[model samples]
Target: MKIAILGTGAVGTTIASRLVEIGHQVMIGSRSKTNEKAIEFVQKFDRNISNGTFEEAANFGDIIFNCIKGEFAVGALKSIEKIIDNKILIDVSIPVNTKNGMPFTLIPELCNTNSLGEEIQKNLPNTKVVKTLNTMWSTLMMTPSMLKDGDHTNFICGNDTEAKETVKILLKEIGWKEESIMDLGDITGSRGMESVLHLWWKIWGSTIGTFSIKVVN
Candidate 1:
């Protein structure tokens, strides 16, 4: 499969590397094709992976992963909305306010009543947007075995059932367990999913290493 990762950040790079390792053709996208980080990433990966501008990646990919920072995600995706129409877009970004280089708060305008997932879906109406993987660290997103041998839970929500199923397949390929993944109904569930970051960050500070939750009866 051809995959486009729309960011040069740790999350995007980590996912791009994993996809390439799993034999998928991957493209890392950024604000510009000349971005030093994206270039470095391509150099470090196999020939199956490449780098390009966001628009170019969108056109090149069969599936698009929106890993752009929450603050910039909507605007960046909106710029190439038409190029990604009808493609499955997996959004793993949450709007965060970094104060003194630390993520201190979720964006005020995008909480409770609205969410980044909804915004992306609203802006790219023709694209199928599935929200997942925003609640944990980037490394954990790709290698769930780091915790409980991949037993920890992951969440996914989207308006399109077929799109969500497609994402679930990718999740399994990347080490997530089918029984461990919970479907929170639709894109509106992203509110709670993104909001959970509040608790995630708090737990992160006190924990010795990475941690995630599992729902059990």
Candidate 2:
């Protein structure tokens, strides 16, 4: 599968590397084709991995992962709206804003009324947007077994069932347990999924380590 990662940040790089490791054709895209991190990734990895501008990467892939930071996610995605139509978009971004330099804070307008997942889906109506991996860090996202043998829960939500199924397969490929994945229903569920970041931030600060939720019966 050809995969497009729309960001050259930690999350995007981590995912692109993993997909490449799994033998997928991966491209890490940024605002410019000459992005240092993107170029470094291409130079370091196998030929299956490459770098390009956002639109180039989007057009190159069968699937798209929006790994751009929450603040700029909407604008960045909106820029390549036409190329992404009719493709599955796995949105792992949260809609957030930093306040007083404190990160992980939610944007005032986004709280309660909207979420980055829904906003992206709304703007790109033809794209099959599945919201997942936003609730956890990038490392845990593609390597869940690193923690408690991958027993923790991972949530996914979207309006399209087929898109969700494809994302679920990708999650399983990355080692997420089948039973550990929770289908939170439609895109509106992104509100709660994204809101979890607030508590996630608090938990990270107190523990100073990576941890995740494991739903119990």
Each prediction's TM-score versus the true structure: 0.97, 0.96
- Report every candidate's CA lDDT: 0.91, 0.89
**Model 2 CA deviation exceeding 4 Å by range:** none
Give the per-residue lDDT of model 2 (tens digit) for 1-217. 9999998888998898889888899988899988887887789964798889999999999999999988898899889999999999999987778663676578766667888888888889999999998888899998998999999999999999999999999888878889999999999889999999889988888886789987899
C-alpha lDDT of residue 59 in model 2? 98
Off by over 4 Å in 1: 99-103
Tell me the tens digit of each residue's lDDT in model 1 across 97-203: 66436666788878899999998999999999999988889999999999999888899999999999999999999999899899998999899999988899889
Question: Which candidate wins on lDDT?
Answer: 1
Worst 10 residues of 2 by lDDT: 95-104
